[model samples]
Target: MRRSVLVAVMAIVSTVAAGCSSDPTDPAPTTSAASASPSGKPTDISFLVYGAPAEVKAYRSMVKQYDVDHPGVKVHLVEVSSADAALRRLRKGEVPDVFLMSRRDLGEIVDAGINQPIDELLDSRGVDFTDLYKRDSIRAFSHSDRLECMPYGISPMVMYYNTNLVDFSEMAEAGLDVPKNHATWTFDQFAEAARFGARRGAKGVYVDPSLSGLAPFVYSGGGSLFDDDRDPKRLDLASDGSLEALTTSLELLRKGAITPTPRELRSTSALDLFKAGKLAMMAGFRTLTPELRRTPGLSFDVMPMPALPDDRTLGDASGLCISAKAVNTSAAADFVVHAIGKDAVSDVAAAGYMVPANTEVAESDAFLQQDRMPAHAYVFNRSVKDIVTLPLIESWPALERAVHGDVYQLFYSRVIDIEALTKKIDEESKAVLSPPKASVTPSPSASASGKN
Candidate 1:
């Protein structure tokens, strides 16, 4: 009887093993389609993006095309008004399969454990990082020696001048030194241009009262924003090089006769003033091009940021990132590859706000838009070489907030103490740069005896 029971158990085990074995004739499963549900339902993934109306429209169109191209997958497009709003959503624990992120926010995003490294995935997807995209842009999204996101847009700040207000040809004829190349100019030449444009009841120029607005000048003057670029401990704005740069920039930026008066600024924004033909020059990025073109009577042109003995400028870089908790990472990565592809990037470039990281499309007419207002559109492309991206640090946003008032005072106040102001900026920055460690709480037993 015992032998008979053993035989029956052995037979049942063999049967179960055979049932679990795969059929030799069955097709292999594909990684790209692995996201499909067990019930054979199509995979669904979400893509979060934020931009202007036209830019949002372009992203929607891309999603629509991607959905059509891949019948087995559906992409849900989520539009936010701005990058800050998107970051808020992420902080609230709303994780999209894929999202657009500013490179500046990479440090914080990584610290939050929300983004996944995609270097191997991108390689598996056949993305040609070296040949297809800008090296600097790619580096902007890398952390811990791994690619955290795929770079999309790289826009360097440039000076946008009203053609009707500041006529370069006329300035040249009047014996004022004008930039012969139009893409390069010295600090003195920039000051002269500003003085010349201060006419027809218009302000000469307006540089934003913020760190980003002043960083390029600091860098070009052989100054550093931080004590150390890679692992910064404090702001170095009071250093000799930085002070010299600030002094030169302030000469033109602080002139009440040239820049918009405080009362005027409170009423009308510098951009609107420029549109109304009441402001001659302003510092802006590529995204401003499309809006300027659409302005009824606004004729504008662009130039590289004025150099302080060096060609340097700040750039805003953004990229596509995959969520660490994505339900379908394979599908999400596929969408990222699609989004940065030549055709997809081209469509957005045509909208005029994106300075595509895709080298091929950046050189195409889609971005240049020869018929547009900024006849010197090439300046945007050329300025890429001069772009100096800020270090990736989690405390950057808070640091900027801490120094905002001081920076504003430095730019706007008529009588100020430069040394004291810069020194204060450094001290305030230290609090964010190296926040104090949290104190340990005493246990009940230890507290009773006042000892551990």
Candidate 2:
């Protein structure tokens, strides 16, 4: 259940997605500055984000428009498929002027010094910065203290179910009132119910490898990821509370509840399986929620991730950040600010995702005025308010690579003991962030990205 973060998987086909082609309602954008940046020159901003080339193409189009409208700014788009690739580029000084990345990736950049503080830029323009969603608007920078990044688009966790495979009537027969679409339920109850669906022959539920689907358990189970001050971002993984949270996922897998799929599918197309009616409950973020509605044969909607015994604080955090070395910092800032304001927020809401990150966007007619949201939408919102992004300290990426490599081994290999697994991970993390033992503590704060 510790396997969760504010960022979720979204395999949006850039060429066709709301990214590349501008919708009519989209605000007009061009790359021109009303005045010269203090730097006194047009900026050449290189933007990097994760996705296939198609997505990058869409970003390129928008960035190109930004460059054109702003006489002094030029933009470049760089695409990478995995978090590792992005890190490598940052380490090699091949970093772009600006970057578009997941919160997880931004955490890595924050330590690398690849991220530039944005306050000065905002101060320069005298922009008040009050129009954004409070959660995304503030926590993004607050998560790491010192305001490291901003949120561009956000997708919250959602519960996706395949009604065809699940017989809601069984609950009625058992005197259990099964919740209808968009209805909320507790984690314990949901697990019990998923077992019900499993007994009836449907894959009761699935948790893809991505963090989006797992963090809810931590919050709902009364587990806290870290102590008050996030100095040593400790692993509450084995906490008794988290153990209870972990049991939910463990139960689903042990009961033969879900058909195993490759992690790549979880990242790229797990929704396709849910749409195929292969699952009763598929935990995912908003990006995967709409397919349940769009698919003719599937009846499903969004729901909260679920609550554990007395647990309540769900991990959630998202924000957009401009690259420190961005050739066009001012122009990039404009795009990010605008994207956070209205246009991009609308796209996110219209796509059936969570409320927009912009305060106005969330309250707009498009958000508040909508009715009959997919199942789980409201519950999901309840958790979204208290979201905690994974700590993005300097060693996080290295720590992530180590944990990712080890967790799969432990899950699949029976020979490894839990103690041994934890030991291996702890040692790796400590080594990566070597504490100050009279000079042994290698600063997790490595040089800024693009410095090579």
lDDT value, residue 11 of candidate 2: 17
| Span of ten consecutive residues with least summed lDDT in model 2 | 8-17
Question: Against the unseen true structure, what C-alpha lDDT does each candidate score?
Answer: 0.82, 0.53
Q: Can you give the lDDT of residue 414 in candidate 1?
A: 80
CA shift of 34, model 1, Å? 8.9
Candidate 2 local lDDT, 1-452, one digit each (tens)? 02222231121111112322232233344333545566787655666766444334545556666666666655566778754677688778786756655565555566566778664444333333443335443445533234456555455565666655555676767876565644456665676567666644446777643223445665566654433223444454456665566555554543433544454355545456567665677766654544455677567755566556542433333445666676666577665654454654554455453455555565565554346435335544454554555544555546556456665543344354545554455455554444445646445565454366
TM-scores vs. true structure, each candidate: 0.90, 0.69
Question: lDDT per residue, candidate 1, 208-250, as tens digits?
Answer: 9888889999999999898777777789999999988988888
Where does candidate 1 stray beyond 4 Å?
1-30, 34-36, 441-444, 447-452
Compare the candidates by lDDT and give the number of the best one.
1
Give model 1's TM-score versus the native structure. Answer: 0.90
Q: For model 1, give the 10-residue run with minimal summed lDDT.
A: 1-10
